[model samples]
Target: MSVLELARAEIRALVPYSSARMEAAGGATLLNANESAWMPFGDAGLGCHRYPDPQPAALVERLAALYGVRPAQLLVGRGSDEAIDLLVRAFCRAGEDAILVQPPTFGMYAVCAHVQNAAVVEVPLAADFTLDAGAVLAAVTPAVKLVFVCAPNNPTGAGVSLEAIDDLARRLAGRALLVVDEAYGEFADGASAATLLDRYEHLAVLRTLSKAWALAGARIGCLLADSEVVTLLRRILPPYPLPRPCVAAALEALSPAGQVAVRDRVEVVRAERARMVVGLGALPGVRAVLPSQANFLAVRFDDAGAAYRRLFQAGIVVRDVRRYPGLQDALRITVGAPEENDRVLAVLGDGA
Candidate 1:
């Protein structure tokens, strides 16, 4: 049997939790699975009495429209976190299979692989924080099931080149899935990997409502992939993966009114990001300001621990990315509201 067939047979024989939604059928009387007798609290504006559509068709349609892809190409999950977990679970086999990651990138890629008992192969980005194509190509083996590239990457905040990603996809065409985690793609200057989805069947682009859309609390993320992949993932995902309230919130967040608000917020964040980069670059003990395509800037400090502590004490909660590979003594500061940015700048200026 082929490798994929062997993998599928192994997975198919493993019993997954039989969710109520999975067992229930579309019938007039729906009396199979026990649901709450009383009505749910609060006017969610959408009916919460009924279980949310297993995949939330309306949301998928709207997202497909927004991302310029077909509905069949999308899978909406709880968040990018869940998407990362699902991809690892669906593709990587325990102990035998592996996945490739670019370090100083998203932690969840490695985290999910670990949870699935999959080996993680690290391909450290170049000193300039661009894709080390040679390193990536060298790391992939037959055991590797997936390769995760975080564009406009987390912490480091640099977008990987489209040419590099395409090349990587081409190399792994039949061997592994190339997942481009575009969680921050909306903030980047170029068109997203969604535009290239048609060209590469092996390419999957992960998008989220958390960053640019300002809907972190809503907990909605989209995975754009080939329909066959989406179908397999859907079979494994939790039925009612999205709660009714979250689905409503996400739908509202993607509305025309919400889109305008998000655009305004994006502009504000982008402007703040630019301003903060310049201001932070001039601070005492500041080593270098990494160019950012995301809403946050990764700043190298002479004393990151001290700076992190000082910022924390001042009621600012920027992320300390010193633990990440190649990012020792670096702090990731998210661009906050105008006044908050000003406060952070003021605190940094004091040289504490």
Candidate 2:
């Protein structure tokens, strides 16, 4: 079955909101939406007087080129979080359908499911925090409509191989939409799941500039899927999803020089990730440092609470991920600047 056919019938039948921007493409005089005729006093380079494009053309084309996808197959949203919410809203009917996610992964999947009043089916990752494909397939009941897999999973940093993902896609075709969230793909090794889009029409890939590109404040992200799927989600998105200033920032970040700087920084993060893993693992109070391809480490300490407080006392903030299942003694620490990383090592190393 086509992915569009899997979306809620109500969504497919509903007419999308016709915004002022969508109505007229060419107009010198702005009076359609009753927006302010004059530009603001502190007008930045990008004029905020007019509503930005629903999916800004220049930004969309730039992101599509960067991710190696056509513009028709991509949808720009607030972030990966918005894409997740939109997916759940489009595919799931409240109290009828469900979405499946692997535990110790991104929490937004289940949160969106709950918000939609849809059931959340969980298949816990293996001991090493890898995808358990068989368990996932077995857990896929008729009610499940979407499956979110975070490549190089969050909190744990274990990635699912392309081969494993291919097998899952083959098996789950026509059954449900397989969404591969590559929020940390730039830091990890190997090609993106977007490369599999042509082979599996039911697959969608999520990417963001928050991590490697260092545009977290801008909140720019893209959802790459089959052209039909992209069209379907656009029906439910806001009139103007991206702000003008954010789009300007994203475009600048995607420029050649910005990209080069991003690459250099990623390499530094990779090196620091390695250094932190070894340094943290050697601490007297530390139990283990999970190896990661992402820019962060999931570290286990003899006394996680103590370690968390110690870092805070030293003015360093690390995520306390003890509440996540199977991570009671672990804290998630992100890779920072050389001196910042040194601060982390020192705080934990000083008789920690």
Candidate 3:
């Protein structure tokens, strides 16, 4: 069965709102959508006077090339967060269909599910924070319409193998859509699950510019899947998703020179991540440092509350994820620039 079959029939049948920008493209003299005739005082050529394109062709084409997918198979939006919301809104039915998630993972998956009145099923990662394919498959029921896997997962920084992804996708082929969140993919060692899209029609990959690309403020991201899946999402998507300046920022960042710079920065982050792992492990209060394939490290300390207080007192900010399942004693630290990292080390050197 097609993945489209899993989507709410109401959403599939409803017509999405069509903005004036989508219907009419180019004309020097503009008079549509009730847009302002004059730009803001400090517009600086952003062209904020008009509504932006729903999916700018250039940005979509650029992202498609960058991720090794076709334009038709990609849907760019505010961020991976928006994509997640759209998926839940379209697939899961209120109080009926559900979304499966491997927890101690990204929180947004569950947040989106609850907002759409969909059930959230947990198939948590192993004690060691590794994905168990067999365990995941055993938990899937007919009610599960979506399955979320976070590659180089957030907070923990553990990654799911592409082979395992392929296996799960194959097993869940007709039953559920395997959604792999690769927000931290550029920093991980594993290749993308997008590689298996050709084989599994029900698979989707969510990628973001927020992490490695340093485009978090730009709010650019995409969902890569079968072209048919992309078409189905468009039916329910907000018509004017990308703002003009944000679109320009994305285009500039995806430029050849921008990509070169991103690669260099990514390498720096990888090196820093490795260095932090060793450095953090050597700290006095740190009990354990989990293995990571992304740009951060999850370190378990003797006293998480004390550790958090010390860092903040020293004017350093790091995520205190003690509230997350299996992370009660852990603090997540992003690998900062050299000097910034030195500050973290110097401050935590005494072990809070």
Give me the candidate number with maximum lDDT. 2
**What lDDT does the true structure give each of the candidates?**
0.84, 0.91, 0.90
Q: Per-residue lDDT for 1-352 in model 2, tens only?
A: 7778889999998899999999967777878988888789888656898888899899899999999999999999898999999999999999999999998999999999999999999999998888999999999998999998999899898877889889999999989999999999998988888899999999999999999998899999989999999989989999988989999999999998988899999999999888888888888988888878799999998899999999998898999999999999999999999899998888888845
Summing lDDT over every window of 10 consecutive residues in candidate 2, give the lowest-scoring window.
37-46
Clashing pairs in 1: 152-159
In model 1, where do residues sit more than 4 Å from their true spots? 1-7, 12-29, 43-45
Q: How many residue pairs clash in each candidate?
A: 1, 0, 0
Clashes of 1: 1
Q: What TM value does model 1 have?
A: 0.93
lDDT of 2: 0.91
Error of 3 at 186 (Å): 0.5
Off by over 4 Å in 3: none
Candidate 2, number of clashes:
0
Estimate, for each residue in 241-323, the C-alpha lDDT of model 3 and write its tens digit. 88898899889989999999999999999998888888888889989999998888999999988888899999998999998
- Across residues 257-336, which tens digit of lDDT does each residue of candidate 1 receive? 99999888888888988999888998898999999898889999999998888888898999988999888989999888
Give the better candidate number (1 or 2) by lDDT. 2
Order of models, best lDDT first: 2, 3, 1
